[model samples]
Target chain A: MTEIATRDAYGKKLATLGEIYPEIVVLDADLSGSTKTEFFAKKFPQRFFNMGVAEQDLMGTAAGLAACGKTVFVSTFAIFATGRAWEPFRQSIAYPHLNVKICASHAGLSVGEDGASHQTVEDIAIIRAIPFVKVLVPSDGIETEQMVEFLAKDSGPCYLRLSRAKAPLVHEASYQFQIGRGHILKEGSTVCLFTAGFITSQVLAAALELSNQGVSTTVVNMSSIKPLDSKLVVAMAEKHQYLFSIEEHSIIGGLGSAIAETLVSSYPKKLVRLGINDEFGQSGSYQAVIDHYGLSTRGILESLKKELKL
Target chain B: MKKRSVAELEDLACELRILILKMVHHAQCGHTGGPLSCIDMLTALYFYEMNHDPENPHWENRDRFVLSAGHTAPALYACLIKAGYIPKDEMWGLRKLGSKLQGHPKLNVDWGIEMSTGSLGQGMSISNGMAMAARLDGKSYRVYSLESDGGAQEGMMWEGAMSAGYRHLDNRVALLDYNGIQIDGFVKDIKDVAPLDKKFEAFNWHTLVIDGHDMSAIVAALDEARLVKGKPTAIICKTIMGKGVSIFENKPKYHGVAPTDDEFKIAMQELGDQ
Candidate 1:
């Protein structure tokens, strides 16, 4: 199995698209190296703008370029991109529906050792509230490449959340990526596991373990957080006896909250959310944080066994 | 559009002042002083200086004007109407729901609005982007932005200031409306943004201080701005909080408030219906 960080894949894809699309420009808030936008910058120096640690200017300038009919990609840590300069993102870019894609890396707890200050667990909730902005969280490197390609051709404001750590390859070369849709990685009737982003690989491993223990489990990768596939969520709810939503973010306003909103509105069912409970992440290795928060395979299996009394 | 003479431009500015007062009085909710303070510069740009076609507003080579002080949209609206970009009848619809003349300038290039701006400090950066775009396309179209003192208080303004100065965007021009008043009170009392010209100078901008209400000085400053090279220009226009109407002039109370029916009559009398 191969592992590649989604940010690495995103940088390669964006640089490749620059050759195809002359109008594509990239902006970063002095984090090109960390965000992996250095690839695009190194290839097309004239088209890249290093905004010099000014996140507000990064967003505002991107909106400005997009206003002039340039497809702009802005990159920074998720904390700074969505939290520090949120107003600029909202007023300058999203409100105008500019052709700017905000590809923020180091999302959620995967930022590791950087602590709670850099880990943006509330980014999905914050960006989702803004109208005309599309939100996406790719499960692996392959899906990230496809999503970046899709966004280059699509015109409008979008937020693509990428992880700092390498993600296990969950999709094969033949796997197709679609926006506003969910992919069912496995099929079972007893329990349905809903997950997205870097946590999808962990959920899949847990599902396999649950199946071996005589608990029929299903796993669905929900990469599109905004414009979510409600139809698929409803269908899964009706088929499975127990449904769970998991993510590498806070349970308040991320994947768990989104799935709960969809379920209660159309198909009412019991939902158990597995993620960081209403608490901030602390400084630690990525694996340690996920394990303590019940995001690791062993922790997830133990929680499932306790819940199912198996 | 045909360029108007200095006397004609001044008359047009007075006419715009009257239009703006009426719009604010009717809307019963809008900024008054900021619009009056910046109306003359807008008039100078629209009637005399800018190379823009009202009929062909989206023309590739036309100069772009961004009203960074967007609470002053009433002034921009009046200029757009006079420029034949927007219908004269829309003046009555200012701040009304379902109207193109929003409380702030919205992005409607066809209406002669280059970009949407209400949040301050962002437009300067946006203007830099437009200027850079022209350089990339090898076009000579200039970008003008009207920003206010209150807006300059935002940290993003300096961010944009640093970028424009560092990039040496000579194609960009920023006109600061040093109106000396904000919603709180006198700008100096609330927070002094004094030495504004020197500040721009420090940021690598060619600085100018002019009487904002003087049509000749406004036109001369804009003309001088175009001659400079290797740097952007910031023309710091020292202006009254309100101009044209005596009752509202130099009064900080009128910064964000509209006039009453009785006060409106007084203002209309002061501005002269001619």
Candidate 2:
């Protein structure tokens, strides 16, 4: 099984797009190497702006460039990009609905060894509440590449969450990515497991384990969390007896809460949410953190079995 | 556009000041002091300095202006109306519900507002971006941003200052409305953002200090800004909190308050209005 980090894919895709879209400009706040915008900076130095540790300035500058008809993409750590510069993001970019792509890297507990200060578990909730801003969490490298290409051509504010750790490929190279859409990776009857970001790989492994135990399950990759595929969520709710949501972020405002909001409004179903239960992350290896948080394959399988009473 | 005489510019400033006072008084809410202090520069820019087409607000090659001290939107709205970007009838709708004239300037490109600004210290960074865009496209249009002494206290302002200076954004010109008053009290009494010119000079900007109400000085400083190369310029306009209106001048109480009916009559009278 091939593996690649979404941040790497973002850098490669942006460098490729820079060759095609002359209007595409990139800005980073002293984290180009970490966030992988350094690739574009190296290739297109004239178009890249190193804003230097000032997130507010980075966001406002991006808004200014976008207003002047430049397709601007800004990058930084999730905590600083969405937390430190939240007001500028809301007033300058999101309020005006500018064509700025905020592709923040090192999201969720996957940012291991950096501690809770670096991990942004509430970024999705904070960004999604802002009107006119689309939120996307691509499950794997292939989807991330396609999502970057899609956002480059699309206009308006978008927040794309990427992970630091690499994960197994969940989608084929020929997979077509669209904004506000989700994909079903597998089919089952008794239970449905919905996941996003790199955690989908674990959820897929859990589904395979459940099949061996004779518990039928379906796996749905809900990459687009903002303009959620409510139709597909409703269909899954109507078909499966139990629905489960898993993510590497806080359960409060991430994939779980998004699914709960849709199900409670349209199609009520028995659902279980699996994620960090309203707690901050600690410094540890990525796999150790996942195991401790019950996001590993074994932990997910055990949680599902307990929820399904099997 | 033909240049207006110093006396004519002063008269136009007085008229625009009256318009600002009336709009804020009718709305019953606005920053009275800063708008009054900054209106003269806005009038000069719109009426004389900038290369803009009010008939076509989104003209591609037009110069850009960002009001960093966005609480002064009343002044901007008055200038926009006087410059023909908006009609005089829309002045009544300032800060009203569903109005295009938001409390702070919203990005209504068709109305000639370049960027939505209200949060202090963010506008200069945006101005840098517009200047960089002009350089990228090899366009000759300039960018101007106006901020108050209170707004200069924000750290992001310094970040933008460093960036503009480092990048040598010669197309960008920033004006500081040095009114020395804020919502709480005098800027010196509160945070003390003094020696502003030296600070900007240290940041690699071509610095100028001028009497904000002097129309000739304002025009000359703007002219000097265009001649500057390899760096941005900062014009520190020393101004009273409320210029031209005697009752509100240098009054901190009027920083965020609207004029009462009696005060409005006094203000209009002071500005040589009915």
Candidate 3:
């Protein structure tokens, strides 16, 4: 399986897109290299702005550039982009519905070795709460590339969450990407596994293991959290007896909450939400952290068995 | 309309102050002191300095104005009215539900408001982006932002100041309405943003200090700001908390409070409108 960090795909794809879209301008809050926006900065020196280490200034500046008929892409760490500069994001970009893409990298516990201060588990929840903001959490590199291209063409405020750790590719090269659409990676019956972000790889592996245990499982990659693919979720809820949501974020306001919100309104189902149980991340290797947080394949499989009473 | 003379501008300022007061009084909520202190600068910008057309608010080449101190939306609404962006009748709808005129200036580009900026310290950075875009697009339209002394206390404001300076966004002009007062108390008492001009100068901005209410001085400073090259300009306007109403002038108590009926009557009389 081809492995690549979502941030790498974001930076590379953004650089490629810059050649075609003259209006595409990039800004970073002094995390160009880390967030992978350095690729665009190096390629389009004139168009890229390093707004120092100020996230608020970065957001405000991006909104300003967007107002001037430029599609601005501002990059920073997820914690700072969505947490430290939330007000500017809410007021300047989201309120006016500016064409500013907040492509934040290093989201969730996968930002290992940096600890809780760096990991942003509530980004999706907080950003989704803001009006006129379309939240996208691409599961892998290929999806991140597709999301970057989609956002480049589309106008309005977007919060694209990218990951620091590399994940196995889950899509084909010719896979078509759509905004607010979820894809069922694997077909099954009895139970459905809803997942987003880099953790989808683990969830897919868990589903394969469950299949071997005579429990046919469906694997759905719910990348688009906001303007959620409710149609698909409702359909899955009806077809499957048991449901589960897994993510590398807090259980409160990430994939689990989004799915719960969707299911409770239309098709209420008892879902086993798999994620950090409202706890801050600790410094460790990506795999170590995932294992410790019970987000690994074995952990997910055990949780599924328990939830399904198997 | 031709540019008004200094005396005419002062009279216009008084009329704008009356409109702002009446709007706030009607709503029974708003930042009173800052708006009155900043009205003269706003009057000069709307009436003479800015290259904007009320009939064509989205004119591509027109100069952009951002009210960073958005609590003073009454002042901006009055200016928008005077500039024919909105009808005078709508002034009464300030801060009302479903009204175009929000408590903070929301981005109603059709009505000529470039950005929404009730949250302090963020507008200057937006101005920088606008200026950078102007440079990128090769357009000569200038970007102006009006911020308060209290707003300067925010770290983002300095970040914006640094970026504007680094980029040498000469087309961007920021006016710091140093009314020396904030919501809690005097700005000096709360957080001293004194020696404000030196701070801007240190940030590599072309700094200028002037009397905010002096129409000719405000107009001249704006003109001088345009001629400045290789750096953004910050015009520090020394102003009383409330300029027109003698009772409210230099009073921190009137910072965000609307005048009572009796005070409104007295304010209108003092402003020579009632």
TM-score (all chains, Cα) for each model: 0.98, 0.98, 0.98
In order, candidate lDDTs are: 0.91, 0.92, 0.91
After superposing candidate 3 on the true structure, give the runs of residues whose Cα lies further than 4 Å from its correct spot. none
Q: Which stretches of candidate 2 lie over 4 Å from their true place?
A: none
Local accuracy of candidate 3 as per-residue lDDT tens digits, B6-108 = 7888888988998899899999988888899999999998888888888888788888889989887888889989889998898888889989999998888
- Report the lDDT tens digits of candidate 3 across residue range A139-163: 8888899999999999999999999
Which pairs of residues have clashing backbones in candidate 3? Answer: none
The lowest-lDDT stretch of 10 consecutive residues in candidate 3 chain B is B1-10
Native contact recovery (fnat) for each candidate is: 0.61, 0.84, 0.85
Q: Each prediction's interface RMSD?
A: 0.9, 0.6, 0.6
* Top model number, lDDT: 2
Q: Enumerate the candidates' DockQ scores in order.
A: 0.77, 0.88, 0.89
Clashes of each: 0, 0, 0
By summed lDDT, the worst window of 10 consecutive residues in model 2 chain A runs over A173-182
Candidate 1 lDDT tens digits, B1-274:
6888899999899999999999999999899889999999999988888899998988988998988899999999999998999999988899999999999988998899888899988898888888888887788999999989999899998999999999999999999999898888888899899899889999999999999999999999999999999999999999998887788888989988999999889888888874
Looking at model 2, residue A183 earns an lDDT score of: 94
